[model samples]
Target: MRYIYSTLGKLSAEQLGMILPHEHVFVDLRTPDKPGYGQADTASVLALMVPQIEAIQALGVTALVECSTGGVGRRADLDLAVSLATNFPIVVPTGNYREPWIPAWVHSADEDELFNWMLAELTTEIEQTGFRAGWIKLSAGDDGITPLEARILRAATRAAVETDALIGSHTIRGSVVMDQLDIIEAQGGSPARFLSIHTQAEPDFALHRAIAARGAWIEYDNVGAVPVAESTDLILRALDAGLGEQLLISHDRGWYDPALPNGGVPKPYTVVSTELIPLLRARGVPEDTILQLFHRNPFRAFSRH
Candidate 1:
């Protein structure tokens, strides 16, 4: 059986409701060395972000993927606090981001050290949050992955293969995602367990197909951030090309920023519910396909069998 790790616990596919495959609750983009980094009071974050979570719940989104990984100031403690408060399920990842965003320690650490850290987080806890990581989230430079980033990628993929966790990168370029898949395969990770996040940024539709053809999932995650027609078109085309099972969709819309006052009036996480689905139905996407996108795909993408 395939199952996913949520804040609620290890849950099978039948346990998950409509899912937002990629989103965030709290993210601090400031580099770790800076002041005000990783210092958001849980009370303040809960007060400001819980309502955003609940609103999505009212719309039937029972689970969300909190894509804030280490280099971007991932706050697993905050994620747990919110989950406990609302009784909602959140799946968080274990990995680091690309250069400059990556912490100083990564530059000096050997590949095994990096792999062991990620393995511990996957098998144990994240920063003492008592919550083991559920997925793998990382990023790459737009031009290409830096040496340190490539080293981290190798380590991450090894951990991913060991744990059967899904690995997604905040990589904007499709070619870089191709490079990442190569590194992952070199580490003996299944390409099907890989996800090319922010794939919309790569306008070359052929790259999307190419990555999917190699058994990697292609994510169009910025649903609410742009014109609905543009997002609708990309999705329709992918569906037309019969890549439904290889595709994942999300708002990428979250985020309670610690840097902002009251988390800076977060953007709504409702585009998928309010706009996209209805548009998809209008354009002839059947309910089963919607069900596959919202439920089955996320489970199969994130779960370990």
Candidate 2:
């Protein structure tokens, strides 16, 4: 059985094959543009996702924790709808507050509005589809959390606490870490439930360790795509510091563009099963250790409401 756990009653970490804790199967920045904002159709989006979905299944991934939030062109209902049809074990869609790299025209949905909408949608999803939401995604740009972002975090915390779902975030490189930590704690969120993406960009073992010490998970995602030596060295450093269990590894991959030569997403960019695990194994990291980072740690941290 896949290990089933929850943050606030929300489920994640089903006992199964490998899981990609944070990723996007389909995203089109063009959807939120003017003239097509609310009018963006689901068919177009699904068309972009189908090929990759097939690829994911082929790669032996039993679950994919999609981090796309509403108001950012990610349709939870549509994604769930498709997942139901495919009978995939899980395709967890995030709630709202998908800022950063947001389309300029996505103005109708602010944090508060998105939060409210998210609650309603979540309820509907549970009642109708029986889809267990494994986690929530919130974002803060390089500047740190704003008032609206705080409101969203508060709402997420409340919902998470109530639902037992884990909270995951995208904190861009720079000074946003403290902001994220503050908001999560202020909302009575346990440090264990927090996941901040891309900590390797700053490469501060001390800082990452501090967060892990606080019971939060710090992701070293997007590192697998770099030169193996450099990436392995960083992973080793984190591990030596006793932070592996707090780690969550991923390529953060799966997107295709006609312009890109491979017709796939870039670094931090590959199907979860394709390159990440193999690269780590080749680098001399034990398979058990890698599984703890990629499979066990994420499941334990993210599922603990």
What's the TM for model 2?
A: 0.77
Each candidate structure's TM-score, on Cα atoms with residue i matched to residue i, is 0.98, 0.77
Highest-lDDT candidate: 1
37, model 2: CA deviation in Å? Answer: 3.7
Question: RMSD of each candidate?
Answer: 1.0, 4.7
Across 1-305, the per-residue lDDT of candidate 2 in tens digits comes to 23342112344454455667766654444435445433334455456556566666777665666665654556545566446555564445455454544444334456556555456544445334545455677777666676666667777777766666667777765357666777778877776777878787765567777777777778866644576456667778888888887888766655433223333443333433555467668778898897787667766755533
Lowest summed lDDT across 10 adjacent residues in model 1 is found at 2-11
Residue 128 CA displacement from its true place in model 1, Å: 1.9
Model 2: how far is 233 from its true place, Å?
A: 2.8
